[model samples]
Target chain A: MMYSPAIIAEAVVNGLMTGAVYALIALGLTLVYGVLHIINFAHGALLTAAMFAVWAVYVAFGLDPYLAILPLTPLFFGLGYAVQRFVIGPASHGSDSNILLVTLGLSIAIENALLAGFRSDTRTLNTDYGFQVVELGPLLLSKPRLIGFGAAVLVTVLLWLLLSRTDTGKAIRAVAKEKLGASLVGIDVAHVYAVTFGLGCACLAVAACLLMPTFYVNPRIGQAFVLVAFTIVVLGGMGSIPGALVGGLFIGVVESLCGLFLGDSLGQIGIFLIFILVLLVRPTGLFGAKA
Target chain B: MLEVRSLRAGYGGTEVLRGLDLSVGAGEIVAVLGSNGVGKTTLNKVLSGVLRANEGEIRFDGKTLTGASSADIVEAGLIHVPEGRKIFPNMSVRENLELGSYRRGRERRSANLERVFETFPRLRERSGQAAGTLSGGEQQMLAIGRGMMAEPRLLILDEPSLGLSPLLVEEMFTLIRRLNGEGLPILLVEQNVVQSLECASRAYILENGLFALSGTAEQVRNDPELKRAYLGM
Candidate 1:
């Protein structure tokens, strides 16, 4: 197929922006998986729930979407902690599959609850900046996309620093490696698990708030992003923060290029094809170690 | 000082350590020796708070530690280097050592890191390398070094010699002796009866979840039953 320079440039920019959001979504799932050893299938539904929460706050109080995140994060953090402590913790029992089932059940329960509560209507955050666009040479960048990308990068960087440099971060890493050994070294494994899940949910909180301005929200919308996030998490290596960042961006660029060169349907299939290829080449992903 | 009385523990319905009693004096190197499946590791697990006792009293430095959380137990300076290395395979050697002091050693993390490096200089040279890549001997040294980073008053090592080369096994014994020389008490759990008895001041022989024999290392070493059962002499 013949490719125009303008089309390629637009595709690249679009992919980068979409990839940023995917990174944010994957960040939490990977973190939870690293420490808790659970796939956390409900993670996508949680993001959708957070989006709806933000939407409710914005539509009711006329608050800025960004400001809604401030209160929303701590709220979701508490929700995540409780979910782990009360629901997920008992079921875990050192079984990986059990946790997966629990999370999958949670995903279904959450999506259906949202469907029952809000119906299947697509709702977008109608901020003034939502429609605003910036033109640089032949490329057009939406204001919301730019802001979402920035927020995703900022949050991911902050999480990386937290996991690498902080005391709590050390404890989280310890538990991830060896729960019994971490306990022997005086880390509360249960507390670490709860807090890690909370932090992961907090990422979704930020992603949901920032993304509302860029995309429409509905009960089933979580599936669209969750699949991409899972692919990024696996591609980046399960627990590697930097890997997630690079993987997200890489997937975004590929998706954008594919959409431009191939059709949209083919582009998604191409993304999955890449996911399978990465798994075959390196099961641990780019940064992950073997399980 | 560490004292465990009537400590009862097991996995799922099968009691591995049934009302076991043991004590280790300050600055003493005591070994718990037994053949495979005698619950030597189970005793370490109960002592380190990794497994809760079904019934018993555990006192460390006169503080009742029964049912206490593992983190609290570690904070109290009771550290356990588990049976397997259990090191964070993905983390660098330095990171694994640094994590050793996550609870109570946070203040002296750098200092303790240096001390561990001194104890296992090879780890210092490969501080940035992933721990899983280390040779078995080096991994054993890393495990011991990680335990040292906690500044443990009473260290429990569960099979530090397991899967080590003959030369490394000798080195492991020497390292235990050196750590004991520094006034650090150790509870060495092992199936290598003869070697463990050589380094320990006191030795306890466990059989079927009970202490079959207990005395000074010399006395336990010369026990005819132990020699017949374990040494195959």
Candidate 2:
């Protein structure tokens, strides 16, 4: 393949944009893991569901795609809270594997349900910004990609502040580190778990809405992103927020580079190869502590 | 300030605390001494609302706390410093201390932080260090300092002396006595019988989920049975 300077610049720009979106996705996964100590396997499916919900609102009510997220976030937040309280909570009683199994089942059920309700047909948001592109010297950026990237960064910063500065955030971190000690200090572990799960789902809802203009959505699309998100979570360290952010961006750039230098299919294979290598070399991930 | 009556609790069909009773009065230090696996930690768990008691009544400041949540218990001013010095490992010493007052001590956070720093000058000196990196003795101080940040009415210290050097252990006991002297009621749970008895006003010995001995520390210390079993005298 002949390499062009313009193409390389475009690839790098695209990698960063896509990396932001991936970080948004992985942030929720990492947050839930950090506080709740469970792998929320259904996280990707929840994102898919949110995407479909946004599409449904757009189709039924003719609401703007961005406007749809306003109502969708709280709706999904409540749903996430309920899911943690009822389904996930019970499964969390025993071994960690129990919660894993339950969430996996939830993922399967959600994907199939979306498939039945919305069909397997692909969908995209019709927005003025969807197809628009802006030029910045040698690099060109899509409007939606720019907006999504901005939103991702904003959300990541907001979450970081919340976890580090606020009382609730500290409570959540305490629960993540030591549930027994948290309870001893009068931190409500159950409430923190519910809120953390809700927060994670809310992040997904936002990511899904932002993602609409940039990518096509379908019932099975979550299957495509789930593995990638998990890979990001694992690579970033299981429960580290900063790790997730850096890991997501790194993966995004790596994928872009692979696609540019290698074939597209080989790019994905290369990403997985990186996952395997990371597992062998730094099992705790780049930022993960030895728990 | 606190009383646990007929407390019974367990995990996975195995009962850990079976019909236990204990109490701590205002400005007093009550030590709970026991061998490992005899439910010293379990008593703390039940009293602190970390574990739900199967049958018992826990009264704190005349409030029923048996089934209350841990946050509620903390809000009620009953704080528990758990075993193994469960400080937030990744957080800075200051952040860990700040979180201690998370539920009910938010308003007095800064003042309490100052008080904790004064008490454990080492913590103040290394307030920005990650708690996990602290030495075992320093971690124990951080744990107690965090507990103090909550402005607890009745603080429960569970095996505070565990994993400490003999010198640090003495220092920890002295700190506990100092805190008690400052008019805070405390429940000190430990395996170090002699020091615990020396520091506590009253003492309880737990064995097989029940009180094996209970009296003033002096009386309990002088008892022939306790001396033989615990002191190897």
Candidate 3:
């Protein structure tokens, strides 16, 4: 197949746009992994819940998805915090497998609850301005994708600043690096874990809102996207923020190019190939420090 | 300032600090010395609330601390500078020190940080560097400095001199003495028999999870059994 330069450039741009949302989803996953040392298989389910919650708000109050961010994000943050404190915190002291089982159980329960409540119907946000396009010389950028990408970059930079500059952020990172060391220095590690989980959920809330315009939400939406998020997390190196961004973009481009050149089904295959290659060649991921 | 009575603790079924009794008075430096795996570190872990005591009572600054969360223990100012220099490897020296005051000394954090820097000039010089990147001796200092940041009422130094050079060991002992001279009570748990005895006002020899010997530093240092086993005197 002969591809023109314009098509290639369009694929690259499309890849970056989708990659931004992927990074948003994976950031929470990696943050939880870093501090709690748990894989948080339920993270995707949590995002699905956030998507439904935002949709509910939009439907009930006729609020824009972007405006719903203010209320839904904080509410989900609290929900995440409570879940960690009351639910995950107890199992966290057990073996890694214990947390794994617990989170997996939670994921199943959440998906079923959504299925029971919302049925298997696909919910889409009917926004007025979603299809509007912004042109940058040769490239036509969809308004929703541009906004999602901007929000992703903004959140990532803000999270980086929070982790590097603030005392609470330092405490979270400290707990992530060394639990005993954190406690020794008077850090309430249990509390940090809960907050980190909450923060992770908050990121999901933001990602859910940004994604509402373009993505269709269903009970099993998490299952569809979470696998891709995991790929991004590993590709970006387990706890590195910048790695998540770059990894997302790489996966995005691969998906777009493969879909364009081969077929839609082959794009999914291409993603797995890259995942396997990264695992085989550099198990630590791109930015992961030597374990 | 610190007391433990009938302390029975261990990893799981095997008891490490079995029915042990010990105490540290205010403005005193007490050392608990033993060879590796003799439960010196275990005692620190139990005291710091990391390991649960099967049956015992621990009183710190007139309040019972047994079974308290590590956070509450540190909040009460009984800081444990754990063995192996467990500084946050990914954090800068400054951040490591700052976290020391996270619970107890948030108000005077800057002041305490300056004091810690003054105490360990090397840590101050490398304040921006990651704790993991520091040399062994520097890491040890950072550990102790991080401990000091909490304004500990009674500092517990667990094997501070472990993996240090001979000269650095001497320097560590001297630093311990200097810290103690400031009227801060310290519970020094170590395998270095001689230096610990020299710096500590009193010493206890732990063996097989029990205190085999206890006396003034001089008495424990000159004990025939101790000399035969530890120093080969």
Candidate 4:
């Protein structure tokens, strides 16, 4: 196939837009892992559930996905808090394998529940701007993708401020670093875990809402994205927030360029190739240290 | 102000603190000194709620704290500065001190922070530096300063001078004495028998998870058997 500068430029832009969505999704996974030290295998499943919730709201009240953010963020936060307090809290002290098994089981359960509840049909949101594209010079950008990208960057900044500047955020960071030491300083470690998990879920709520206008959702859609999210999280360092953002953008660019050069089926292979290469070269990831 | 009776605790199946009984009066600095593996750290863990006591009664300021969560124990003003200077290494000195009052004393956080800085002028200068980068002696000071920020009624220091230089060890003991002089009760756990006895009003020499000797610092320091066993006198 013949390539042009305009084609490459458009691909780069497309890559960045999709990368932002991945970053937002991966941020939730990293935050939970940072404090709880659990991979939260069911994180993508939670995203799928949030998408369905937003979808239901849209179908019932005809509310815009952006407007759905107000209620959904808190709703998922509560859901996350409950899950951590009631489900994961008791088993947290167990061995790593046990926790992994629990999360894996949870992933399967959520996926099955979505399938049972909504069937296997794919669903997409019908927004007025869903198909609209904004022309900039010789390149065109999807309106929905641009909004999603903007929201992702905005949330990232807000999260960074919260973690570095707020008391609650400092407490979360403390718990993330040293659990027993955090208690020595009078931190409620279990409560911190719940809050961190809630925050992670809240990110999923935002990601789900932002993504509705751009992508189709189904029970299995989460699986497609989860591997990519995991790749980004590992590439960025397990719990590094900035690392997730960078990794997501990088992966998006790589996938876009690969799809252009090697065709669609080979795009995922390209991602995995990079994942394995990173794992081989730097097992701790780009930002991670040898733990 | 702090009391632990017949405390029995251990890791999994192996018992460490076997029926250990200890007490500290208000405004007194009592030291629990022991060699490694004798369970001094275990006792601190039990008191701080890091490990559950198999059988014991812990009373702090007349409140039953035997099985209270760490947050509750800390809120009750039984602050434990854990062994090996367990400061939040990635956080700045100020942030580490701020976390000291996460559960209690938050209302007076800024004032308490200033007070801590006053106590350790060196820490004040390095308030923005990461705790991990501080020297061993400074880390211990930071740990204690962080504990003080909680406005602790009773402070527990575990191995505060573990790896300090001889000169720094002297400085640490003097600092502990000054803090105790301010009418704050302290339970100093250490293996540095000589300095600990010198600084503590009363001392307990633990062996096999039980105190083999206990008395006033002068009395214990003079005890022939205690001196020979711990100090190789």
Candidate 5:
């Protein structure tokens, strides 16, 4: 079966758009990993919770998902900070395995709680912009997805500025590199940990808002995105911001092409195959600092 | 001025610093010299709030900091340049220095940065380079420069000369002396006994987690046990 150039272009465009969203999902994971050095198993659950938050507000008050980002971003940030400060940081006690187990346990608890509250039903925002599309040359891109792409990139740029240009961001990088040194300089280490986690969650909140309009959410929806996110984090280099963004887009294109050629289920395998290959060939990741 | 009373600290079941009392008066350079395994680094840790005291009191500038957090201790202007030159390897030299004022010197960060650059002209030259890429001596200079950025009321330097070459070690001692000449009280913790006593106004020789001998530099340097154990007289 031969596909037309138009179809291929559309597929690539779709992948890029989706990849931008994936980058948003990954920004948080990369930031958390860069500082905390832990694979937050609960990241997906947090996404699901943020999606539900957006969904709940939309359903109850008719607030737009786009608008929900304003309130939800900071709310999720606070939530993430509290989780790290109160739950994860204290419970893990600075041990790697303990952090892993605690996050894993938190993931299970959150998923179950969401499963109970919202049940297994898939909820999506049926906004007026839901069916809108923009015509660009021969390709028709979904308006919401385009917004998501621009917004994700914008947020990433903003995050880069925060890290490179601000005091809090410098403190975060310092803590990421040297925790004891960061404290010796008077940065509250616990506070910086919470802030980094909060920023990670805030990224997820924005991603959740972007995804809610074009996508549906259930207790398990975030699991799917997070699996791809983990692949991107590894592919891009664990702690590199640009790596996450580009890795997300690269994986997005790869997944899209794989779906077009190998079918949907196998397309998922394409992601993991690349994940393994990257691990084997370039264990430091594309942007990871050389050990 | 900084004062520690019967400071007792250690890791797990083994005590590293056992019931040691020490102090640094204002405008004084006090050296705490010891050999390996004698709790030099451990005492620095306890004073810097990286480790807790098993039993004792730490009062910095009249504020009891026995239970204070690292940030609180720093806010009190008791800055510690830890052993091993724990500079953020991946960050730029300027960034590592900028982070020195994360707690205490925010308003004067730029000014302190300029002063650091002036003090360490080599740092200014390699300001944009990653710290890990710097030579060993340069990294030590960066570490001390970082501590200076904190506007330290009392600066504590731990093994600042550990890995430097002999010539660089001489420079390190000179820089320590110069910093002391500026009216800053310093607690110089080192294994370099001879130079430490030479550089400090007062000296405390640590042994078995206690101060075995302490007095003015001349007295401690002339002590028979110090000469026998450290100088191999």
Candidate 6:
């Protein structure tokens, strides 16, 4: 079974588009982990909720999913901030394990809540542009996916700028490295933690908007992406932003190529196989915390 | 000026600072000298508001800060340069300094930064480099220099001389003396009895969570028990 170069190019392009969204999903996860040192098991559930928000907005107001990004990002940011500041912060009480358990419980609670409200059926917005495709030489790329890749890149760049140039970003990095030192400088560790968590959820909202056009929404839809996002977080290193981005793309390509050779269902194993190999070799992750 | 009355703090049934009373007046270099595990760190933690005092009143510039968070303490201009020189390892030297004025010294950042660079010219040379890459002496200098960026009303340096070479330790004291000469009150917390007494206007020898001896530098240095226990006289 020989594949032509055109097929390979198309596969690579497809992989990149998928990988871009994966990176966006992972950006939030990595940022939270970087600052809070929490695994954030609720991430997928949060994504599911955001997707539902997009679906509800579209169904109710006939608004475009792309337009929903504006309001939802801030809305989710507030929700995440409140959850971390009021709920997670007090409940965790300065314990790492407690935070992890809380996030896990949050994930389960959110899943069940969404299940009760929306049921188990998958829902998707059938936008006019959803079926459109871009003809790129020998490749016929899905328009929404192409936009997802470009928007994802734009968001990544913006996020990078925010973290590098803003006062809040500096405080976040400071707290991530040294909590007591950050507080000593009047950073208000709890505030920074909540802000980081908010930024993370905001990223997920943007991702949900982009995903809704071409993807389905369900209580379990996010579960499909969250595990890969976690693997990307670990593969890229636990807290490194660039690591998550690069790892997401790399994993996407691996999955695509493995599917090409090993079939789709079995190709999923490619991600885990690489994850194991990376763990065995680097241990800290690629671009992880700077060796 | 900063004042503490009978500060008592501990961790989980093991009391570290019990009934400790101390004060630092304006423009005074007050040294709290204690050996390892004698509650110097605990005192720093309590003052900085990282650790809560069990029963005490801390008045800084006439405002109670005993129950305040570390942010409030910092906002009150009681900057703490903690032990182990906890500089953000991955951030650049310049960033670490810039973050010093994050709450209080924002208006004076450029000027204070210029002054700090002038004071620590070596730090200026490596301002663009990662702080973790700096030598121990430089990191200690960075920690103190960071506190200076805050323009603190009272600067607390916890074990600033730890891990420095003997010559560098002397140099550190000279640096502290110069900083104090500029009329910034300092709370010099250390285990270095000889140099601390030399640099401080007054000194207190802390032992077993309480001050065993405290008075003017001359009085503490000439005390018989202090010389016998600490200096092996």
Clashes of each: 1, 2, 0, 0, 0, 0
Residue B221 alpha-carbon offset, candidate 3, angstroms = 2.4
For model 3, the stretches where C-alpha displacement exceeds 4 angstroms are A1-4
Cα-based lDDT at residue B83, candidate 1: 91
Off by over 4 Å in 1: A1-3, A262-267, A276-284, A288-291
Angstrom error at residue B26, model 4: 1.6
In candidate 5, stretches whose alpha carbon ends up further than 4 angstroms from where it belongs are none
TM-score of each: 0.94, 0.95, 0.96, 0.97, 0.98, 0.98
lDDT of 4 by residue, A1-291 (tens): 879999998998899988988999999999998878889988889999999989999999998999999999999999999888778777756566777777788889999999999999999999988999999899999988988989988998999899999989999998888888998877887788899989999999999999998888999888778789999999999999999999999998889989889997887777899899998988888887569
- Give the interface-residue alpha carbon RMSD of model 4: 0.9
Q: How well is candidate 5 docked (DockQ)?
A: 0.84
lDDT per residue (tens digit) for residues A1-291 in model 6: 889999888888888888999999999999999999889989999999999999999999998999999999999999999999999999998999999999999999999999999999989899999989999998999999999999988998899988888877888999999988898898999999999999899999999999999999889888889999989999999999999899989888888888888888887799999888888888889888654
How big is the positional error of residue A166 in model 5, measured in Å on the Cα after superposition?
Answer: 0.7
TM accuracy, model 1: 0.94
Cα deviation of A236 in candidate 5 (Å)?
0.6
lDDT of each: 0.89, 0.87, 0.90, 0.90, 0.92, 0.92
Q: Whose lDDT is higher: candidate 2's or candidate 3's?
A: 3
Error of 2 at B222 (Å): 1.5
How well is each residue in A1-291 modelled by candidate 2, as lDDT tens digits? 788989887887887888888888899999998877788889989999988988888889988777877898899889998898888887678468888999999999999999899888998877777889989888888888888888888989998999889888988888888777777777777778888999999988888888887788999887677688788889999998888888888888888889989978777776698899989999999899886
**Candidate 6 regions off by >4 Å?**
none
Clash-forming residue pairs, model 6: none
User: Of models 3 and 5, which has the larger TM-score?
Assistant: 5
* Model 3 alpha-carbon miss at residue B57, Å: 1.8
> What is the C-alpha lDDT profile of model 5 across B96-186, one tens digit per residue?
9998988888899999999999999999999999998999999999999999998999999999889899999999999988998998899
